[model samples]
Target: MEILSTPQGDFELSRFPIRSKETLRAWDAADEYLIKVLHEEQLLTSDSNVLILNDSFGALSCSFSATRPVVVSDSFIAYQGLLENLQRNNIDQNNIEFRDSLREYGEVDQPYNLVLLKITKSLAQLEDQLHRIRPHIDKNTRIIASGMVKGIHNSTLQLFESIIGTTTTSLARKKARLIFSQFNPELTPPQNSYPKTYTLESTDYKILNHANVFSRERLDIGTRFLIENLPVSDHYQDIVDLGCGNGIVGLMAASANPAATINFVDESYMAVASAKENFTKAFPDREANFYATDCLKGILPSSCDLILNNPPFHQQNAIGDFIAVQMFKESFIALKPGGELWVIGNRHLGYHVKLKRLFGNCITVASNKKFVILKAIKN
Candidate 1:
């Protein structure tokens, strides 16, 4: 945990699922830059109705807690992080309202005075959010968004201008930049065409993906490789699709093992929702469990007969193997004795070494030029 000093207050913040010797801070320079600017300009008042988007770790929400801002995000982990940080800072979380990104802003009773967006890695998610929030903002609404220099591109600015209004940017500060967008009531923003559906190749099932879902446009190559090589057996009764994006892996597993009860899990609410919808559409008669949680956090110990994982290599903009490492460790704990954990990842991620270290043995199940599939048995 680190101290994040802002004009509102000094908050000791840490990322969700806090780890020992954690090097990453919960807040970033972009978060600090936005808060500094907001404070200096006196843009907020006690009665101001504020909405904060994609606050990865509650930096903006906690900073402006006094205003009772409505915090919105699609990530379950990020939601947990915000709660954890708010508790750590001894702030009354009851003052703040938390909303899932899937919820429509049309339900809001009043127009927001200010909207602070911490630009996310998914441009689709950003675009969807802009469309959703468009109905709730007027010309007087102040929309300030912040992101790292590398994250803000021409496409990013284009979305703001096209969807919101006339958008501009501030000069870079500490490798972070702020975006200013004025609400243009004249513009009729395009309707959100998200939750897209596509036919799964070689199968009759169609997959539906929310805007923020990974590989929303099509089956990503890595997942496609995993789908082609899924291990299906009658002995695997309780199978889990860890990091189940759109629940395709689990759906395939279910197709093969009709008797097996599939559990679809992912941290993204939108991902889980898409998975549930896709699964229900594919197998209306079948029953499965879905969870939007940190990998296997609430799962029973040694209860799963099989676990399929395509671990994410990064959290938001910061790319690293920390998330994959955690998923591997959790998979080991969640698997029953003699059960198997199957993983497919890029060849360079070195997942075999991690699996061998955790499960004491690892074997290559399949491999292509770009992706490799590894299997580890919990003995």
Candidate 2:
């Protein structure tokens, strides 16, 4: 991995989970663009309290460690990566305060006076983040957002205008763009408009979704397909829902196995949170564990008797099978001998081959025109 060399400092940063053997640097051009803006504007001082949002792999926080920035993100994996990056850079652990976007941050005497935002793919989430920090901002506060040129658009600028105030963009530099938005106290602060809830008519149950949770509006087609074909058995006592968005898979599994404990794991804090809410609503007297984690990293090996998954083939705008492959690998580690790992994924992703590679066997439980449900058993 290339050492991130910016005006702030030169530090070797690697993304969390090291998805592949060839490590990719955590920082990007947008990170550089924002770092440059902060330097050119001379926004730093010993007392320059800062809030960094949507920071992927902690580039902003690592660069602005001297400011004791508050780091906010929806991805627990990103937060963990940030901590790892800070440790690598020899920054004090206390220099950065990590906050998950879904949780509340209590009152602090010295609120953030500066904000560095990395535009996320989810515009709704971006709006929510801006809304979340609005109340703490003052006239003197400076907010600058950065993203790749391809990500910024008219709607992006409009969101800034509506949430913050008048906004202006900088010329594209190194394929990245920046927006400077003024803090307008007149902009009516938003109510907690996140963790949106909707009803699943099939089960007569309500599902809650936070801003960054995938398929937040409703049950995604793949998961819906999986739910319709969920494997049920009385033999499996502990079930794990890998990448459990809103815990629907686990909810379905729990409904199938009344005596089993369901474990819901996902990288998104909001997803885990929404899953917990939905689980409680779905099964009032059930036992469960909701973990916002990176591919079952801390889960006890071979502890789960069965694992259910709707593996994500992409993260943000980048599409690939790496995430799914890692999930399968993790599921293999977490499942007990003779236990089953059930998953529904796109037909084109060829998950069966990967499962066969890892578990030595893969069986198609079911298949539709666009998706396939596969079950792999641990020997």
What are the Cα lDDT values of the candidates?
0.91, 0.85
Q: Write one digit per residue (lDDT tens) for candidate 1, span 169-221.
A: 99999999999999998997777878798999988888899999989999999
- Ten-residue segment with the worst summed lDDT in candidate 1? 101-110
lDDT of 2 at 313: 70
Which residue ranges in model 2 land beyond 4 Å of their true spot? 19-23, 105-110, 189-192, 316-318
What is the lDDT for 97 in model 2? 85
Assess the local accuracy of residue 250 in candidate 1 as a C-alpha lDDT between 0 and 100: 95
Clashing pairs in 2: none
State the TM-score for model 1. 0.97
Q: Pick the candidate with the highest lDDT.
A: 1
Evaluate residue 379 in candidate 2 and report its C-alpha lDDT on the 0 to 100 scale. 96
Measured with C-alpha atoms, the lDDT of residue 213 in candidate 1 is 92
**Weakest lDDT window of 10 consecutive positions for candidate 2:** 103-112
Per-residue CA lDDT of model 2 for 209-298, tens digit only, reads 988888988879898899999888888899999999888888988988888999999999988988999999888887799898988888
